[model samples]
Target chain A: MRASVHRAVEELLSEQPAEEVTLPLIATRAGVHPTTVYRRWGSLADLLSEVASSRFSGDIVVPDTGDVREDLERWATAVATDLADPDTLAIMRAALGAGPDGGCACTADRHAQLEAILERERSRGGRTPSVEEASDGLLGPLYYRALFTQLPVTAEWVRGLVRKLLS
Target chain B: MRASVHRAVEELLSEQPAEEVTLPLIATRAGVHPTTVYRRWGSLADLLSEVASSRFSGDIVVPDTGDVREDLERWATAVATDLADPDTLAIMRAALGAGPDGGCACTADRHAQLEAILERERSRGGRTPSVEEASDGLLGPLYYRALFTQLPVTAEWVRGLVRKLLS
Candidate 1:
């Protein structure tokens, strides 16, 4: 039943903007009772966060080639690519609209991934920035460019940003 | 009449989220015909962009004590303060929702302000980055932290970011 609702949301999101995806619409599309949805998800923000978590949560697989720069580049490039997806971007925007303390599962998972990578660096005796610092320095630029500017978040651009942060 | 409309938008925005501030609501609040608003602004995106531009657009007055760091710190701190406002953040989110090429006048003006600052740095033989580069590097982190994280964009934080960029 949850899977059906999630699939319905994904379909609706693909067809329309996130703001237009109402609970009634999801219930109708998924063939589930509206009450069931309300009982389970409680709110649109919670429902979307659940969807985002299911889609985006996971352990980040970083290459252990021993070079922090290369590993960071690979991880950042992957994240940039994921964020560049129209669907992912839509979900993220929805999460952001829910406010900072709104428990955005995707962003939480991303934070964990960043912490893991930073921990690896710290263990290697490399200069490891705080998760907040690393997030603002690296992921912030990618999101800012993706969401605000007309510039493409290209691999080359990601590479340049990594170099700037490292230097 | 324009002032009335702007005032209505500001009033509505203060009371409700940007998405809920429809043209009819603005028309009702401003005591104007809905058609007049449609004719003038065409869309909610345009209306919000106009509101944001009127509120945020201007020549950024960075101090010119021949110290780029101090000037940048002042400028960034001011911007952070502006963005921390709920109304400004709402309008900005609306503009972002309208997409990158949606011609948000406020964002364009902010970009222009950043360009002007960078041009001054270039004249001073400082390593002036491209406007896009500088924006993603400096202003990006500020906006990201302000909008996403719980961290306050303090003057100290702005100063540290400026020093990092300059270094």
Candidate 2:
């Protein structure tokens, strides 16, 4: 039931903007009572946060090819590709709007993934940027450009970020 | 009348979240007719974008101290300080939500300011990061921390970003 409802939301989001999506609409699409969704998730924002986190967990797998730079480049490139999609961008906006007090779950998941990559690099005797550096230098710009500017996240730009961070 | 409406929006945003702020409410606060606002701006999102752009233009003054590194650090620190305010964050989110076809006016303003700083550096024969580098390395992370993460934009973090970019 939970998975069906989440899937419904994703489908709705693909069809329309996040702002236009509502609980009752999602309920009708999922063929469940609206009360069920409300009872389980409390609000659309919370539900969207969950769906986004779940999607991100599966969508962006961290890379580990022994070389940290290669891993980061691949990881960033994959993320950049994912964000280029309008659906992904909508999900990101929805996740950001909820603004969980503890921080958004999707970012937490990404941070953990980032830490895992760094930990591997450290164990393998490579100097890796702190999570902070990587976030600001690589991840932050991808999102900034996606949300704020019209700039496309190009291969050249992504490669430059990884090289700059490693340099 | 235009200035008053923008001021009204800012004042209302300071009192409540951006989502709750409406065009009619802004008109009421600004002492203008709802139709006047409607006819002038067309919609709440457009109005909010205009208000946000106006606020950003005045709020974040770019620095030109003849030294690019020092100037960027100070400018970033000031931005960090501004973004720390809930009101500024609300404005930023509102501006982003509109997703202007050309790009949000506030960011265009910031990008232009960033360019001015870079141009100054080049004219002075001082090596400076390209706008892309500065955006990726410095500005992107500040906003990323502010909007996406729970991390505070500490002075230490801002200084480190400047040093990394200049290095």
Candidate 3:
């Protein structure tokens, strides 16, 4: 049922809207009763939010090989591969779409989740960045480019950044 | 008429089916004849493709400050701003949404346009990095994260990346 709901929303986002996404649309698409959809997830936004989160909201997969550059390169390579996946990237694009005219709890939550993982990395070594500003020093450009540009991330870029951070 | 059709397609993307992105929709939305739309662009796809390109398409805004770090930061900042814009990014998202469907000239053209700009940047310094790889050693991560992460890009990250490139 969870996967069905996720697939339905994913399809809905990709296609031009013939209908506004709602509980009824999801319930119909999932071939489940409206009550079942509602019982499992109370609202349309709620269902969609959780569905989006669970898709990429997994373990951090941090690697600490005692070399910051190597660790960072490995982390970035994995991230680049994941983002290059059309399905995953498309879902992320939708979540970040239009910047929440009202407010999207899901978007906010996902962001918080990403930040938390980055924070864990920031604090892992004794030389942790001291402020959100310092953390931004490490993460800001990468996040901005991933969300926006068509640039294919290369391996050297990752290694260079890790080297810079260590230096 | 071209602008009318483009606007009509834009509306369809936001709230209705692209099939509805027709002459009648343009007529009703812009108070013009359906023929006006066809006359200007020959078809809805032509109108959409043109408009989508014009909307999202821009050269990479590469800089030539002699100092590679400053130039790179300027370039990176422009990209961040472009990706953060909902209109341009939304058009690309919509095109990608059509998936591996027929006649997706818009997607391919935009991709090529971006790549050409990147290629131009590569040849500028005469010390060419791999054309097979993303440029500037690790700038790919900057672009990728900027586009996909949907986070507020910080000045510090920009500065750090600039420093790395110039160093």
Candidate 4:
């Protein structure tokens, strides 16, 4: 029953704003009593956290092919791809749910995850942070493109940036 | 009269998400009749665009102290300051008004505005397009901070990042 309710909430989170989501609606979609949902989750906030936890688990796997740049570019492309997806963007907006009522909401958890990933990348290949350089490699361009423009995080772009930064 | 109406619309855009800003409500706030307000702006979209246009204009004013690094840090901090401002964020989200609506019911004008900004920035500072490099400088940390954390964008944080990238 909890699993079913969770799935329903996840669906809503992936498509609807939080203010637009209601317990009765989830119950109807999940074919369970609304009472059961409210009884278990207590509120949409609690339920939404669980859904976000399952979705962005900070356990983003970064592959190493003996090339640090290759690894980062691949990883950034994935993050970029996720950001471009409507489902992921919707789920993110829903969880944050409009304004500082959302302050300290899902972000701390999200950063904890990204920090872990960054730390892991830092350790690999013994590449110290480069100050003389122009920018961070893979993640930087991938995210910049995704956030500002409709451009894809292409392999060529990633490789070119990675090579330039690495040199 | 136009100035007063603009101020009223500015207030509306900064309100919490759940609050509605109907035309009559703005009219009352601006000391104008609802019909008078509608007469000038045509529709809510027209009113909001005029309000947002005045608000979002102005460049980061990159100072050329003859050092690109100093200029970059200054620019980055300005960007971060803009991003972390509560009223600014509220206005940004409000202007976008949820979803792929792209900040207006019709996005052609909005798209043109954004493209013009990007192009102008590229040509600004008498620099050429290192699209990736500029993207990283302008957007990389801003998005990372905004999308993932509630931490107010501090001058120190922006300076640290700008130094790291531009150093």
lDDT of 3 at A123: 70
- Expressed as tens digits, the lDDT of each residue in A3-61 for candidate 4 is 78768877875665444467788888899988888888766656665665567665366
Across A64-141, the per-residue lDDT of candidate 3 in tens digits comes to 676544655676566666666666655554443322311232234434543544466567754543334323333443
Clashing pairs in 1: none
Q: Write the per-residue lDDT of candidate 1 for residues B48-149, one digit (tens) a residue.
A: 667767877774565675766677777787888888887777666655444333324556777877777778888988886688777877877987776566
lDDT minimum window of 10 residues, candidate 1 chain A: A95-104
For model 1, the superposed segments whose C-alpha errors exceed 4 Å read A17-19, A38-42, A98-106, B17-19, B38-42, B59-62, B98-106
i-RMS for every candidate (Å) is 3.5, 3.2, 7.7, 5.4
Instruction: Per model, state how many residue pairs clash.
Output: 0, 0, 26, 0
Per-residue alpha-carbon lDDT of model 2 for B1-167, expressed as tens digits? 99899889778877864445677888999999999999998876677667777777756778988788889999889978987888777667656544442135657777778888899989988788889788877778887788788787889989998898888
For model 2, the stretches where C-alpha displacement exceeds 4 angstroms are A98-103, B15-19, B22-36, B98-103
Docking class of 1: acceptable
TM-score of chain A of 2: 0.92
Q: Candidates' lDDT values, in order?
A: 0.73, 0.78, 0.51, 0.56
| Model 3 regions more than 4 Å off | A1-4, A10-25, A33-49, A64-71, A97-125, A128-167, B8-50, B58-74, B81-159
Candidate of highest TM-score: 2
lDDT of 2 at A124: 82
Clashing pairs in 4: none
lDDT by residue for model 4 (B31-97), tens = 9999999898765546655555566555345455555556566656666677677776655444433
Per-residue lDDT of candidate 2, residues A1-167 (tens digit) = 98999899888878864445688999999999999989998876678778877887756778979888888888889988988888777666656544442135557777787889999999988788899888888878987888777877888889888888888
lDDT of 3 by residue, B118-162 (tens): 556566753423422323333444434433444466667666655
